[model samples]
Target: MSKRRKRKPKHFRGVYALLVFPFAEDFHLLLDLMRRFSAAVRYAYNRLLEGKGREELKRQDDLLCTFFRLNTRHADDAVLKAQAVLDSARERGEDPRKVVFGGRKLFETLRRRHLSGKPLKELKREWKEKRQGLLYSRGDRTKGGNLNLRLEAEDGALWLRVNLGNGRYAWALVKTSHPNLSALVERVHASLPYNVELSLKDGKVHATFTWEEEPTPLAATKENGVLGIDVNSDPYHLALAVVGPDGNLKRHLTLSLEEVDRAPNRGTKELLLWKIAHQVVSLAEEHGVAVATERLKHLPKGRRGDGSGRAFRRKQHRFAYASLLRKVHSLARKKGVQVVEVNPQDTSAIGMLKYAPLLSLSKDVAAAYVIGRRALGFKEKLPKGYGKLLRDERFRDHAQGFYASRVRELQAKRAQEQNPYLRRRLSREIGEAKRHLSLLSSLQGSPGSQREVTDGRNSPGVNPWRVLRVGTFLPLLGREVPRDLSPLKVFLHRGAWEGWRESRGPHPGGGPKRANVHFG
Candidate 1:
């Protein structure tokens, strides 16, 4: 065998920190510089785009001047700084223009011009003093130790003392290299303070500043494991599951809005959802595990009609699921945890049907059964008498035969039905229900046979109840397993399996042999 090649680990590049600092007198000067830089950047970008296409224009600078709704002048200043970097780069044969600009200077300039009225000289002096304090009081660097500073003008504002330290200060240099250095600086200053806290990671410098108010740390990953979450409206539930070393569920928790309401009201469900997602991310980071959820594409919606049936009036807010998934996913990524999405179709209901008979019955017994199994570590617990169950083969034979007969009945019924839409719907419903029933029936005879069966008609496949359960718990189960019985096997047994011949050549015995395949 050929030697396996070692794969390289993937690396990610991102802004490690967006420092925000309070506006000081010198902040005005920084703002002025940012405005000029922004103007320069814009001018350069426009000049490049005049003769170039979109792709070329984007490549012409390290950072692009994307305008935001908050401040027009600041946006314009960003453009100016971008232009300056391009011009400077072209003159010096260095791609300074390629450096993405920060919004520090732009915000400072705008704040000075439109919000605050601090004088430039006063602000400069204060900044100088602050630098001196950092050098002397903090003992970080000696005074007059090769401090590099520059002044620039482009967006009707002036920038002064844009300084970079020698080694760790390389980040400062990168920050200032942007055409819109002022804007970049303003953003940094807004987010972080000077010499308050700083660190370097993966070649990037991160800094934090003291602020009176800060957003509460969101719910995060714990050292134990990540809490897998599934978001829904009305009955907002969280299926908190822990992952093991092999990346399978170790323990599962099912917490709902009702449970939350049982305690004193902390906030609205939306707030709770946000907190939960953030906490999950934080926990994942702390625990060094991955948080998994389902990737929901188009959600089922109520059909528009004469407003007669419940189907026509079912209100499903697609945004809630989309937003929660997005928030959790993004938070997970930021916290350096894996956020995965699995298929959402029948994860919960199937699991419930498979594990219910083993649990004590209650209202919504099917849902509770799966939740309890997951919580009790059933997935990790192998059946006690697997050898006996396999040796008997009776359950398997009965399940296969039943599935085969039901498949034929549904196929025939589908073919005879005249209404195309109704025929397809009923066929799918009956087929899936029969397949599920067959699996449950087979599992019933196994060592753990507490699996419960729910009425097919009452439990629509995509019903919210089913959706919430599946989306919440499926990822916790880790991987899909082949059901003991399915329509595919039934079709094959009846010699009516479509696409079977296309899949492979005839065997030496001149017939196809049954193969096990897992469907999710």
Candidate 2:
């Protein structure tokens, strides 16, 4: 046997930190610089979109450097930022022609916002409203440009020197009174960040840095175990469950989210989110395990046509799952914990159905338990009721067989019927029976994967078979499925496939094989 190749370990992890700046007289100059930078970036973006070739865009970048009177490096930065946005949109399947930004959207792009403590959902709304002006700027990543910031030792006092664009400098004293000042300054001095940002908030200057720290990547396997987190609303913000490699629950934790849930102010909500992030990181560190959470996606805007109240709609909008995940992942990385995301499908229902009774835990904790098991590559056993539903001979074999037999009978009747209208009716009935046979066969083989069974259905907690209840399951007692079974079925007077259809003829077979019928 050949030797196995060793996988390379990931090294650098990103960190965001804030440093305060003080200025009394040059505040107006700082604002002026922000406006000019924003204008230049917007112009470059529009020009980039209009250009058809990469070489042509490079030519335009050179012209912008002259027209904007910006340094060559700074002008190149603007072009790169524009290209990054266009590339991202294209990757997401968005049309490039419709991706133009204007109004408040353009100004919002001027800020280095990942460092902002605001929840991403709220920040997005504010970004799209009027002009919030520039609260921050991620200036050129080089050593000499606007974002070039360094802590200098002068006259035995710690001072921060920031290069404002247009070859200007602003100095601020590092106040010894601030609790985190020493730590912040020491980190910057050690890392010497490549990119820096300047922010003007509450009439005070602040500098933001995106630095890379030494990485402590986890091993390929963690025998100690995994941490599963379920993010939810109300009294408990998150439910965390730790499970061993053997798939047994080790511990359960609930983070109280009362303050964030009840907060009326956006700032307070943001602060509470920070505290939650810290808690998650601390827990992961204490356990020395990998972190896991549900990978939620394609969230609907609201309960469409469901008659949900205004308060309910507003509450749905305020819960930002993506932002909270970002915070937790970032903090966990800093502490050397590996983060894992598992598919969110059926996690809540499966937990409630299988593990809740055995562990005597709430549904949320049980769901977290399922998530942990998923991350560990362990299979969760189906509930006993689910197995019984699948094993029922009527559902597994007889229902589909009935439809198939009825389809054959109708085909024979269509051939014998003399009246034109009666022949057409027989043909239609045969087509309907064939279609139902296909659907039932699909379910018997793979119940949840069939388009007819899963389409337009979003009820997560209900049993999959129950969605086909009433007209579908009840039809077994009678000769035909009720009219209500197909709300959209039209009167099919024509034969199957209508006019000029290719025929492969019929199958020479016995009742479709025993292996296909029984799922156990």
Candidate 3:
């Protein structure tokens, strides 16, 4: 009999197991331990800022070890992690000297400010003032840093240990009796932890363990599934649109992340973030799709102009768009789900104008729809009622009259203004109004015997401008046109001008044919 072959599992996927302190008594010991370790990291960071290289830092590690009362290995890990952070900062156009150290709070602050679009100078100032941070590491096959902190599930009990570099280690028994934490403990028993982080939160010790497993691979194409999310500030924190493989809406969800917003401290904020991350991963995994988010990397810093009030600035500072994206992205990566960032321009406007009324969705939900459509490379939808307004002669006449009156008013204003700035502004407004009037007149098929083409595509010959104008503005009026069709191509396809001249009599050759403006 032939032996059956066993297929290897997929690449390891990362899952987090958060273990809270079982015994309240160990809290102070863990806090003091973290504080001293944080101090050691700060010391190495200062020396590195003073131009100390890895070799010099290694040689001087013992000096810091003595100063901070840390063991030799602990000191080495601190220097290594500090150097890594400094190198990363310098590479990202940030000054290494401005690096801060205040343990987990420092990391959280930087993350918050980065998402809030705080200026780099301001961030540096905050860090320079704080000058403290935590040094957390994952465990290796052998000995390593606190990030290398390890945990195991064996003999019906959870065993946690963190080597403090000498014969001494911080060991604890994590409680698995509670229903809330038992599942996480069982997971540890199933697989050895791949990474670990130890931190002091609210004066209580908490350890986060990461385990590796094979992820269910997601399809590469958008057809498989797509998740569109709109991050906003209000009653609903996230508006999500789930699209099926057939370009059909599967579900819509609005998540209220008020807790993340109302979080009173860094620890609470992180807890909220972790919860949100888990929710996102669960949704992505369930749908077997990629998540879509706005590309908000260049979001402007809060309340920059004179028009912005102090209250508005404070609100902007607390906006969580960037932080939310980061958390979703990090969790999604571990789950092997794809993340797509769509351009955020006009999403709200397009959503309000088109999808809001059609889908009977809220402004935020409509925007989420647009975001999803964009990620899927679908054409933007048009409002059903917009066509009648554009096609109505009364509406066209009213529009033209409005702009013409505006032009005259602006011209009068320009003449009356003695101030150069006011006059220039008036002149500019006058020119703009006139241009709009002219464009409208051309669109409405001009009143004069000799009609001047206002469509930007043509002139003395058969004007391709008519086709260009139709193609450009038709969509705004609920008309869908082929995107790849050029002005000349569209004109030829209709034989619009040829038919116009044929109707004018047997004159086969004449002046350039006036384009027929009536296109459905």
Candidate 4:
């Protein structure tokens, strides 16, 4: 056998170039061309479906050329490509409508032809110099100038420039004949700034452009603690587990969204997201911790039924869930927090207790439960006390130890057993049980400690916050929880901080009469 070598950690630094395709003047022309081409293709396909004669179709194609004011060659090519796609789809037992509206294959072909070309690095440099000249001249009459491009590389940083209109963007495709170049063409056509970066560690490629404003920096991660998060429409809730050396909860911080919604601006949504994400990072920095969240990405939404009403509601529910998951992921990455997605099905409802209740379980747990329920031949009744049991620090330790021993035992049994069928059955059952146990164990232990707690019901000596609700928002703190009294008790007291109006100014009516007042 060949010896396996361990892989080393890798990293890379590169710039993200934003290349704009259609210079302002040419954008409308390009849009017209696309619309004309689409209409032509659809027309031809319909003709074919109606069993039109070949000569008649050829005449129609010619007419399409005249209608779009394109040369016969271009029109012919578009017709052929569209027909080929439709024919291919029909052969594969797919609807032609699905194939036409669905853009993956079409876009893939374009990318292969246009985006894959000579090193974009060289083109980017050229564009930068031209852009500088234009800027220096104060937008002097530079007729037929190149499109503006922005370069955001690690070393050079963020800079913008323009390239002369030599048709190099179009010529690159003609020269390379690589289909991938179509991606570059399409981007340029969109008239948005674009750039690409390469990550050497995993050979991962990242592309960014004027699609949306650059994402804010909100990435965070914890070195030691586990962050339990709950996802909801109103607000995202977070709970941190600060464990002791003995794997007990030493302290925790809970954040909710009430503060976020209180902001007056319409863009409060994005601002709130950034604020909460930054707070999570700050918390992690103060007391090293990792983050955990329930993976509710595919949690079914919508009442069960067969009618269109149910379908429409389900679709809306799916959209909401998807949007929530996206925000969580984006925020998590910006914070550098290790986000572990647990299952949602059982985490919220199972074995949930008062003091360390599983407010939201990770998606992984839900996945495991799905497999477990199937393997155990149960009719899928919700697991009882599974959530609370999983959250128990002691139970988690036991489950981990149990899984390790069970795996070893299974290996030994496999080595001794002769019957393949029995061995296979036993192996599957063991695997399912282990998965379930592992998920439960994760909830039982605090985020960082390796030690196992033997008692499932014992308080981990952690202070529970009285005022903090599951999804309330919190401001950034400069210090870790105070050591004198429990942090939880302090948090409860702090929650009663005076209102903004009382602390900053008198009433709007210019009156200072009220003794005291509180609003929820």
Candidate 5:
């Protein structure tokens, strides 16, 4: 097997809770330890950039212990944190020499504080707290959850035991609104490993507990059936389809995610996503079927000023596919449901051309149907109707003619349009029309059993589905994604070369031409 790609660790996103300490203990002592730990982290970071390894740094951690007044454990964790920061900077393609432990944003804020009418003293205080108010202790399985810091359950409430240097320890009552604190407690009781983090935010101390959770063995299997999920952006809903083992649609439904968009804050929105994830898993468990979803990629949001980049970000900001999918995957694992990720390529087009009209299902639901079938290890063959449409010379000509007219129209407008943005938009349309014309023009010979058409050297291995998608959708139906796909029913059953559609001469653009509403 090839080398596996490194991904984010499978640990849970940790829980942050308020730390309430006893009045008798000196909180400043905790503050002093935090200051030393922060200094060691920065020192180790600089040393790492000079080519020092972790083990080398740890062996001579006496320099950190003596200089920062920290113990061996704190010194070790400081090296770990510094290594993490360096690795992250390299991953993001940044120079490690310019790495700022306190954050560059805080430095910039000092310059902007006068404009915002905020006091310089307060800004400085905030910056200082950010730099020195961090503490971290990694867990050791041999040491029962943690070494320097530990969580002890006492009287139904969780309290943190913090180690101060030279045989001194401090305790703080850990209070959290998060419901998963019990899971942390369970790990602590079982002597399983768990990491601890403490940071001061606005004078209040907070503790974070994190661990990698092992998933339960999958109960639901694809042998029973598959439930495919499609998250649509425009309507802001999740479309689901239940496909039987034989690859036939059993039932389908949609769950609205509009409430997540309307949420007032990030935390609330995350909670809402988790709730939606629960519902999806519950459905899978109820049907005893594995879940299937698109294996989406992380495409970079390009820099602004480029027309395509701006357009990409505008649409991307309005949806939450990855975040929601991660939640779904995490919840499914815990619930003992299997989740199969399928390649999203052509699933949309295949659904639009084949199943939409045949099953009278919506486009999103049809795509879900394709996903379910694919997860069951089924290869999608071209439908007979669509295959026949590709072989029809008249149909291909009509499609090419429509795109030719569109290209001419866009080029005409692009010449006269004064606005650069509008001209750029017109250029994009012109390029799209020319591309469609190219694809349709490339179809030379008759498609065989596989219905594969050689799309020429420029575009190789063009299948019937692609040509059918380009040929039928905009040319026959008059819209890329028509609000009413019922019109495609005729193309599906009767024939793709519609006489009435082709009889109407191609308008300037894809839409119908009308003069004063085509009558007045």
Candidate 6:
């Protein structure tokens, strides 16, 4: 068997520290430098986009230095900062011209400050601090670490010296009680290279130290087992499953993201996410198994102006799926834990169809289990029960009929609906129902591997799995993706798929058009 290709083991680490200025003059001086540095960065960003190189912009007599009252090193740092920002924007496919010096959201919030019940002065102050109060200094190995802003460790404590330009320097105490600061202490004492960044927020100055290191060797292995994770947005939770070497579930659990939702501020929320990431990585370390997660694709956060309910939009916005995954992947690498990204195709559908009812696991947990199994190179075969149901002609017809009835009812509802939002919602459901009708119309006589089949339905593809999901989830269950799928267990038994009887007569509560599903 071929071993997995190992990537370069590069580590990025950082710790936070608060800067305590001794004298008021020193505070004011540093604040002035930071505000100028912030302005210089924005100016440099625009200049960089105009094709101006750093060599011309970072000279001591250059306008960037003279106008900003910045030293040559600070001017150079500004250009570097601008280039980093530009590179990040391009990576995210964002319009570099539209980049806001201050965060766009924060700037936008100032316009509607009255709605937040906060004083306008306070709101503007927050915006100004973010937009103007910033400073950065890159470390140089030749200068015994950072040149413009060097860290010093004395008697188990840290201090920072800020070069104030014009032959002046100010010393400030680094206030942090973090236990891991010992590693930083050691690095500072050894004069290892480190980058320092300072920013003002909430009327206080905060500092972050960043450095690179070699990552540890991987200790966890797939041969031991795999810990699979799946993030769900609706309820906002992470479902995890520990699959053994034999592809059987050894354990399962879930971590709630409600606390992250309830956090009062962005800082607290970010800290909570990091805490959760640590818990996940710690579990993998304890199990001595590699972690498995799906390669994420861009998920549409429902537009608030249309399409989605307020609650749904809020959930999607706060999902943190990508954020938590990054934390887990990065932390795992630093700690020498194995991580595997599997193709996310059909993990959800396969789990809902087979394991959700078979093992009585929730849909999310079942999906996680499938991820772990796939990571171990196990293939999913269509269950015998599902294979038999797929071939049942009556089953296919009954499922098709359910959607056909739904489409008629939905179109009538949409026409009568006065509210635009409700009409749009109805129209969407009708479209889905019609699509299912088309899918069922082209059902094959036998189940086979997933492949494309076209027959005037304008469908790109049809497979046994899609047909089964389309037939069962909405037709008999009346839900596209129900939270509790144990109800599907009954249909998993013999003759259950085609075994549903429906009354076409007038319904007891509504009308004759509604078909009441009854499982026999």
Clashes in candidate 1: how many?
A: 74
What's the C-alpha lDDT at position 93 in model 3?
A: 90
| Estimated TM-score for each candidate | 0.34, 0.62, 0.53, 0.34, 0.83, 0.85
Report RMSD for candidate 2. 14.3
Model number with the top lDDT: 6
Q: Which stretches of candidate 6 lie over 4 Å from their true place?
A: 1-9, 109-118, 233-236, 256-275, 303-307, 384-388, 441-460, 483-520
Descending-lDDT candidate ranking:
6, 5, 3, 2, 1, 4
Against the reference, the lDDT scores of all candidates come to 0.39, 0.57, 0.58, 0.38, 0.79, 0.82
Which tens-of-lDDT digit does each residue in 1-520 have in candidate 2?
Answer: 9999997544343224334446664556655554554556666667777774434444545665566555554555556656776888788898766764544354555465664445665555544331222323343334432354556656766666654656787666644444444554565555444344454444444554444446666642346688899976533468999888888999997887667768799878877887898887777778777889888765665753343445556667767667778788777776678888888876765565456645667768888998998888876544444444444544445456656766676687788888775676567566766666665555554534322222223433333433233112323223222212121111011112211022322112213322121100
Lowest summed lDDT window (length 10), candidate 2: 485-494
lDDT of 3 by residue, 85-160 (tens): 8878888798777665554565776777664445656665555434422436544434321233556556876767
How many residue pairs clash in each candidate at the backbone level?
74, 0, 12, 70, 0, 0
lDDT of 6 at 242: 95
Q: Could you tell me which 10 consecutive residues in candidate 3 have the lowest summed lDDT? A: 506-515
lDDT per residue as tens, model 5, 1-520: 9999998435364677998878555577888899889888998998888898877777644678788878778889999999999999999898989888788988887766554445776678788888999899998999988989988888898888889978898888988978787778788789888889899778888888888776678899899999999998757899999999999999999999889989999999999999999999999999999999998867455445545645456555758889999999988878888889988877887787778888988989998998898889887766666666776777777778777877876798899999887787678778887888887887756333245322111123465677777776677666666545665666566555553365554333343341111100
Clashing residue pairs, candidate 5? none
Residue-by-residue lDDT tens digits, candidate 6, 1-520: 9999998756888889899988878889899899999999999999999999999999888889899888898999999999999999999999999998889987777766455445777777888999888999998888999988888777766889899987898888999976668887777888888999999999899999988988788899888999999999867889999999999999999999899999999989989999999999999999999999999768788785565578778878888888899999998988889989898888888899889988999999999999999899887777766767777777777777777777787898898999999887777777877888988887763333243321112223456667888887766665678666766665566534433342232122112334543321
Q: In candidate 2, how many Å is residue 263 off?
A: 2.6
User: What is the C-alpha local distance difference test score of candidate 1?
Assistant: 0.39
Question: How close to the true structure is residue 348 of candidate 6, measured as C-alpha lDDT?
Answer: 89
